[model samples]
Target: MRIKLENGKQNELISLAKRNLTWKELAEKLNVSEYYLRTDLFYEKRLLNSEIFTKLSKIIESDFSKFIKLKLEDNWGQKSGGKKSSGRLKKVLKPEKSEELAELIGIILGD
Candidate 1:
Protein backbone atom coordinates (compact mmCIF):
# COMPACT_ATOMS: atom_id res chain seq x y z
CA MET A 1 0.00 0.00 0.00
CA ARG A 2 1.00 3.62 -0.57
CA ILE A 3 0.05 6.99 0.83
CA LYS A 4 1.02 10.57 0.17
CA LEU A 5 3.26 12.25 2.75
CA GLU A 6 3.43 15.87 3.89
CA ASN A 7 6.27 16.22 1.45
CA GLY A 8 3.81 15.14 -1.21
CA LYS A 9 5.77 11.98 -1.76
CA GLN A 10 4.35 8.48 -2.21
CA ASN A 11 5.59 5.69 0.09
CA GLU A 12 4.91 1.99 0.32
CA LEU A 13 4.79 -0.58 3.10
CA ILE A 14 6.22 -3.35 0.97
CA SER A 15 6.52 -5.62 3.94
CA LEU A 16 7.71 -5.88 7.53
CA ALA A 17 11.05 -6.57 5.92
CA LYS A 18 11.13 -2.88 5.03
CA ARG A 19 11.23 -1.67 8.65
CA ASN A 20 10.62 -4.49 11.09
CA LEU A 21 9.87 -1.86 13.74
CA THR A 22 6.68 -1.57 15.74
CA TRP A 23 5.01 1.70 16.70
CA LYS A 24 5.57 1.14 20.43
CA GLU A 25 9.20 0.18 19.94
CA LEU A 26 9.79 3.16 17.75
CA ALA A 27 8.25 5.43 20.41
CA GLU A 28 10.61 4.07 23.04
CA LYS A 29 13.58 4.49 20.77
CA LEU A 30 12.65 8.08 19.97
CA ASN A 31 12.04 8.83 23.66
CA VAL A 32 8.54 9.91 22.76
CA SER A 33 5.23 8.65 24.02
CA GLU A 34 3.26 6.10 22.03
CA TYR A 35 0.44 8.59 21.80
CA TYR A 36 2.77 11.07 20.23
CA LEU A 37 4.11 8.41 17.92
CA ARG A 38 0.65 7.35 16.82
CA THR A 39 -0.37 10.93 16.41
CA ASP A 40 2.56 11.46 14.15
CA LEU A 41 1.68 8.35 12.26
CA PHE A 42 -1.88 9.49 11.73
CA TYR A 43 -1.84 13.26 11.67
CA GLU A 44 1.69 14.37 10.93
CA LYS A 45 1.93 11.65 8.31
CA ARG A 46 5.26 10.53 9.72
CA LEU A 47 6.52 8.03 12.25
CA LEU A 48 9.43 10.04 13.63
CA ASN A 49 10.20 13.71 13.57
CA SER A 50 12.97 14.94 11.32
CA GLU A 51 15.77 14.68 13.87
CA ILE A 52 14.50 11.50 15.42
CA PHE A 53 13.80 10.15 12.00
CA THR A 54 17.45 10.54 11.09
CA LYS A 55 18.48 8.59 14.16
CA LEU A 56 15.85 5.96 13.49
CA SER A 57 16.97 5.58 9.92
CA LYS A 58 20.38 4.52 11.14
CA ILE A 59 18.91 2.35 13.87
CA ILE A 60 16.63 0.35 11.60
CA GLU A 61 19.22 0.12 8.84
CA SER A 62 16.80 1.97 6.54
CA ASP A 63 16.28 5.42 5.17
CA PHE A 64 14.00 7.84 7.04
CA SER A 65 11.70 8.10 4.06
CA LYS A 66 11.13 4.37 4.35
CA PHE A 67 9.57 4.89 7.77
CA ILE A 68 7.30 7.67 6.58
CA LYS A 69 6.37 5.70 3.52
CA LEU A 70 5.69 2.60 5.55
CA LYS A 71 3.52 4.39 8.06
CA LEU A 72 1.51 6.02 5.34
CA GLU A 73 1.15 2.72 3.62
CA ASP A 74 0.15 0.92 6.78
CA ASN A 75 -2.39 3.37 8.13
CA TRP A 76 -3.90 4.84 5.02
CA GLY A 77 -3.69 2.15 2.41
CA GLN A 78 -5.98 -0.28 4.14
CA LYS A 79 -9.21 -0.77 2.22
CA SER A 80 -10.27 -3.83 4.20
CA GLY A 81 -11.58 -1.65 7.06
CA GLY A 82 -10.19 -4.09 9.56
CA LYS A 83 -7.31 -3.92 12.05
CA LYS A 84 -3.83 -4.47 10.68
CA SER A 85 -1.03 -6.24 12.40
CA SER A 86 2.65 -6.69 11.51
CA GLY A 87 2.64 -10.41 12.19
CA ARG A 88 4.78 -11.95 14.94
CA LEU A 89 8.23 -10.34 14.95
CA LYS A 90 8.41 -6.60 15.47
CA LYS A 91 11.02 -4.12 14.41
CA VAL A 92 12.63 -1.70 16.84
CA LEU A 93 15.36 0.85 16.74
CA LYS A 94 18.66 -1.05 16.57
CA PRO A 95 21.39 1.36 15.62
CA GLU A 96 24.85 -0.12 16.10
CA LYS A 97 26.19 3.36 16.76
CA SER A 98 23.65 3.87 19.53
CA GLU A 99 24.86 0.71 21.24
CA GLU A 100 28.45 1.74 20.73
CA LEU A 101 27.75 5.13 22.22
CA ALA A 102 26.14 3.55 25.22
CA GLU A 103 29.11 1.25 25.77
CA LEU A 104 31.54 4.12 25.30
CA ILE A 105 29.68 6.21 27.82
CA GLY A 106 29.61 3.35 30.27
CA ILE A 107 33.36 2.90 29.91
CA ILE A 108 34.00 6.62 30.34
CA LEU A 109 31.78 6.82 33.40
CA GLY A 110 33.33 3.68 34.85
CA ASP A 111 29.96 1.99 34.91
Candidate 2:
Protein backbone atom coordinates (compact mmCIF):
# COMPACT_ATOMS: atom_id res chain seq x y z
CA MET A 1 0.00 0.00 0.00
CA ARG A 2 3.00 2.23 0.23
CA ILE A 3 2.77 4.28 -2.97
CA LYS A 4 6.21 5.54 -3.88
CA LEU A 5 6.43 7.53 -7.08
CA GLU A 6 8.17 6.00 -10.11
CA ASN A 7 8.68 6.93 -13.76
CA GLY A 8 6.49 4.34 -15.44
CA LYS A 9 3.48 5.00 -13.21
CA GLN A 10 3.61 8.73 -13.71
CA ASN A 11 3.41 8.32 -17.46
CA GLU A 12 0.56 5.90 -17.08
CA LEU A 13 -1.38 8.29 -14.86
CA ILE A 14 -1.10 11.13 -17.35
CA SER A 15 -2.04 8.83 -20.16
CA LEU A 16 -5.01 7.58 -18.21
CA ALA A 17 -6.12 11.00 -17.10
CA LYS A 18 -5.84 12.49 -20.53
CA ARG A 19 -7.60 9.62 -22.24
CA ASN A 20 -9.97 7.78 -19.95
CA LEU A 21 -10.99 10.00 -17.07
CA THR A 22 -11.06 13.67 -16.30
CA TRP A 23 -9.33 14.79 -13.15
CA LYS A 24 -12.75 15.40 -11.60
CA GLU A 25 -13.96 11.90 -12.41
CA LEU A 26 -10.74 10.40 -11.23
CA ALA A 27 -10.97 12.34 -8.02
CA GLU A 28 -14.50 11.17 -7.47
CA LYS A 29 -13.51 7.60 -8.14
CA LEU A 30 -10.63 7.96 -5.74
CA ASN A 31 -13.04 9.46 -3.16
CA VAL A 32 -10.91 12.52 -2.73
CA SER A 33 -12.14 16.06 -3.06
CA GLU A 34 -11.69 17.93 -6.34
CA TYR A 35 -9.53 20.49 -4.61
CA TYR A 36 -7.14 17.78 -3.53
CA LEU A 37 -7.10 16.22 -6.97
CA ARG A 38 -6.26 19.56 -8.52
CA THR A 39 -3.58 19.99 -5.93
CA ASP A 40 -2.28 16.55 -6.69
CA LEU A 41 -2.49 17.11 -10.41
CA PHE A 42 -1.61 20.79 -10.67
CA TYR A 43 0.20 21.70 -7.49
CA GLU A 44 2.43 18.61 -7.49
CA LYS A 45 1.44 17.20 -4.17
CA ARG A 46 2.60 13.64 -3.71
CA LEU A 47 -0.13 11.21 -2.70
CA LEU A 48 1.45 9.48 0.31
CA ASN A 49 -1.13 7.18 1.85
CA SER A 50 -1.19 3.59 0.79
CA GLU A 51 -4.98 3.25 0.79
CA ILE A 52 -5.70 6.23 -1.44
CA PHE A 53 -2.77 5.58 -3.68
CA THR A 54 -3.71 1.94 -3.86
CA LYS A 55 -7.22 2.86 -4.94
CA LEU A 56 -5.84 4.96 -7.77
CA SER A 57 -3.41 2.21 -8.72
CA LYS A 58 -6.22 -0.29 -8.79
CA ILE A 59 -8.27 1.98 -11.00
CA ILE A 60 -5.37 2.46 -13.38
CA GLU A 61 -4.20 -1.13 -13.00
CA SER A 62 -0.66 0.05 -12.50
CA ASP A 63 1.79 0.25 -9.66
CA PHE A 64 1.51 3.36 -7.54
CA SER A 65 5.11 4.44 -7.86
CA LYS A 66 5.03 4.33 -11.64
CA PHE A 67 1.87 6.47 -11.69
CA ILE A 68 3.32 8.97 -9.26
CA LYS A 69 6.51 9.37 -11.22
CA LEU A 70 4.45 9.91 -14.35
CA LYS A 71 2.44 12.61 -12.61
CA LEU A 72 5.64 14.28 -11.51
CA GLU A 73 7.22 14.10 -14.95
CA ASP A 74 4.13 15.42 -16.71
CA ASN A 75 3.61 18.27 -14.28
CA TRP A 76 7.27 19.20 -13.86
CA GLY A 77 8.67 18.20 -17.27
CA GLN A 78 11.74 16.80 -15.59
CA LYS A 79 13.62 13.77 -16.78
CA SER A 80 13.53 10.69 -14.65
CA GLY A 81 17.04 9.56 -15.42
CA GLY A 82 19.34 9.54 -18.42
CA LYS A 83 17.90 10.25 -21.85
CA LYS A 84 14.37 10.23 -23.20
CA SER A 85 13.89 7.83 -26.07
CA SER A 86 10.85 9.38 -27.65
CA GLY A 87 11.79 12.37 -29.76
CA ARG A 88 10.20 12.03 -33.17
CA LEU A 89 7.68 9.34 -32.21
CA LYS A 90 6.25 11.69 -29.62
CA LYS A 91 5.65 14.28 -32.29
CA VAL A 92 3.54 11.77 -34.21
CA LEU A 93 1.23 11.42 -31.26
CA LYS A 94 -1.16 14.29 -31.60
CA PRO A 95 -3.85 15.22 -29.12
CA GLU A 96 -6.14 12.58 -30.58
CA LYS A 97 -3.37 10.02 -30.43
CA SER A 98 -2.77 10.83 -26.80
CA GLU A 99 -6.47 10.35 -26.12
CA GLU A 100 -6.43 7.02 -27.87
CA LEU A 101 -3.40 5.90 -25.96
CA ALA A 102 -5.10 6.93 -22.75
CA GLU A 103 -8.17 4.93 -23.72
CA LEU A 104 -6.04 1.90 -24.40
CA ILE A 105 -4.46 2.22 -21.01
CA GLY A 106 -7.91 2.43 -19.44
CA ILE A 107 -9.12 -0.63 -21.33
CA ILE A 108 -6.09 -2.57 -20.23
CA LEU A 109 -6.76 -1.45 -16.71
CA GLY A 110 -10.39 -2.62 -17.14
CA ASP A 111 -11.91 0.78 -16.45
Candidate 3:
Protein backbone atom coordinates (compact mmCIF):
# COMPACT_ATOMS: atom_id res chain seq x y z
CA MET A 1 0.00 0.00 0.00
CA ARG A 2 1.20 3.49 -0.87
CA ILE A 3 1.21 5.93 2.02
CA LYS A 4 1.64 9.68 1.84
CA LEU A 5 2.73 11.97 4.64
CA GLU A 6 2.50 15.72 5.12
CA ASN A 7 5.45 17.74 3.83
CA GLY A 8 7.33 17.94 7.13
CA LYS A 9 6.24 14.63 8.64
CA GLN A 10 9.41 12.92 7.48
CA ASN A 11 11.55 15.41 9.34
CA GLU A 12 9.36 15.07 12.42
CA LEU A 13 9.74 11.30 12.30
CA ILE A 14 13.51 11.59 12.07
CA SER A 15 13.58 13.95 15.03
CA LEU A 16 11.42 11.65 17.13
CA ALA A 17 13.50 8.64 16.18
CA LYS A 18 16.70 10.42 17.13
CA ARG A 19 15.37 11.22 20.60
CA ASN A 20 15.09 7.47 21.37
CA LEU A 21 18.03 6.13 19.38
CA THR A 22 20.92 7.32 17.24
CA TRP A 23 20.63 6.96 13.48
CA LYS A 24 22.98 3.98 13.50
CA GLU A 25 21.04 2.36 16.33
CA LEU A 26 17.74 3.01 14.64
CA ALA A 27 19.04 1.50 11.41
CA GLU A 28 20.23 -1.54 13.30
CA LYS A 29 16.85 -1.95 14.97
CA LEU A 30 15.08 -1.60 11.63
CA ASN A 31 17.55 -4.01 9.99
CA VAL A 32 18.45 -1.43 7.31
CA SER A 33 21.65 0.38 6.60
CA GLU A 34 22.18 3.72 8.25
CA TYR A 35 22.98 5.34 4.92
CA TYR A 36 19.70 4.11 3.47
CA LEU A 37 17.72 5.45 6.41
CA ARG A 38 19.46 8.82 6.30
CA THR A 39 19.52 9.33 2.54
CA ASP A 40 16.69 7.36 0.97
CA LEU A 41 14.11 7.30 3.72
CA PHE A 42 14.62 10.49 5.72
CA TYR A 43 16.03 12.91 3.15
CA GLU A 44 14.36 11.60 0.02
CA LYS A 45 10.90 11.10 1.55
CA ARG A 46 10.56 7.58 0.25
CA LEU A 47 7.28 5.77 0.80
CA LEU A 48 7.87 3.12 3.44
CA ASN A 49 6.34 -0.32 3.34
CA SER A 50 3.87 -1.37 6.04
CA GLU A 51 6.40 -3.70 7.69
CA ILE A 52 8.87 -0.90 8.08
CA PHE A 53 6.12 1.37 9.44
CA THR A 54 5.14 -1.25 11.99
CA LYS A 55 8.71 -1.63 13.19
CA LEU A 56 9.12 2.12 13.35
CA SER A 57 5.92 2.54 15.34
CA LYS A 58 7.08 -0.12 17.79
CA ILE A 59 10.46 1.55 18.21
CA ILE A 60 9.05 5.05 18.61
CA GLU A 61 6.13 3.92 20.77
CA SER A 62 3.62 5.98 18.76
CA ASP A 63 0.94 5.13 16.25
CA PHE A 64 2.12 5.72 12.68
CA SER A 65 -1.44 6.52 11.58
CA LYS A 66 -1.09 9.97 13.06
CA PHE A 67 1.36 10.93 10.31
CA ILE A 68 -0.59 9.42 7.46
CA LYS A 69 -2.45 11.89 5.26
CA LEU A 70 -5.40 10.70 3.24
CA LYS A 71 -6.38 12.39 -0.03
CA LEU A 72 -9.64 12.05 -1.90
CA GLU A 73 -9.66 11.10 -5.58
CA ASP A 74 -10.45 14.66 -6.67
CA ASN A 75 -7.36 16.07 -4.91
CA TRP A 76 -5.11 13.07 -5.36
CA GLY A 77 -2.81 14.59 -7.97
CA GLN A 78 -3.02 18.20 -6.88
CA LYS A 79 -0.01 19.87 -5.26
CA SER A 80 -0.41 21.86 -2.08
CA GLY A 81 0.34 25.56 -2.16
CA GLY A 82 3.82 25.79 -0.65
CA LYS A 83 4.69 27.64 2.48
CA LYS A 84 3.59 31.27 2.45
CA SER A 85 6.24 33.94 2.44
CA SER A 86 6.41 35.89 5.70
CA GLY A 87 7.22 39.10 3.74
CA ARG A 88 8.49 40.69 6.93
CA LEU A 89 11.95 42.06 7.50
CA LYS A 90 13.89 40.21 10.15
CA LYS A 91 17.11 41.07 11.96
CA VAL A 92 20.22 39.15 11.08
CA LEU A 93 22.60 38.11 13.82
CA LYS A 94 26.35 38.58 13.69
CA PRO A 95 28.55 35.67 14.79
CA GLU A 96 30.31 37.58 17.59
CA LYS A 97 27.06 38.95 18.99
CA SER A 98 25.43 35.54 18.72
CA GLU A 99 28.27 33.98 20.68
CA GLU A 100 28.01 36.72 23.31
CA LEU A 101 24.27 36.17 23.59
CA ALA A 102 24.84 32.42 23.90
CA GLU A 103 27.35 33.02 26.68
CA LEU A 104 24.86 35.26 28.51
CA ILE A 105 22.14 32.62 28.19
CA GLY A 106 24.48 29.94 29.48
CA ILE A 107 25.41 32.11 32.44
CA ILE A 108 21.78 32.85 33.28
CA LEU A 109 20.77 29.23 32.96
CA GLY A 110 23.62 28.14 35.18
CA ASP A 111 22.41 30.43 38.02
Q: Which candidate is the best by TM-score?
A: 3
Candidate 1 residues 1-111, lDDT tens each? 343334422123212213666777766866777776556543545443355555545674655464243443444545444445446557798666688899998999999
For 1-111, candidate 3 gives per-residue lDDT tens digits of: 445667777666666776868889988888888988888788745666556667777767888687788523333334332233345558997666687788898999994
Error of 1 at 109 (Å): 59
Which 10-residue window of candidate 2 scores lowest in summed lDDT?
69-78
Q: Please, what is the whole-model Cα lDDT of each candidate in the order they appear?
A: 0.51, 0.57, 0.70
C-alpha RMSD values across all candidates:
20.3, 19.6, 14.6
Give one digit per residue, the lDDT tens place, for model 2 in 8-94: 454455456536778778778767777766666434355445566666667767654533432332323244332454453544554
The per-residue C-alpha lDDT of model 3 at residue 43 equals 75
Clashes of 3: 0
Decoy 1 TM-score against native: 0.34
Name the lDDT of candidate 2. Answer: 0.57
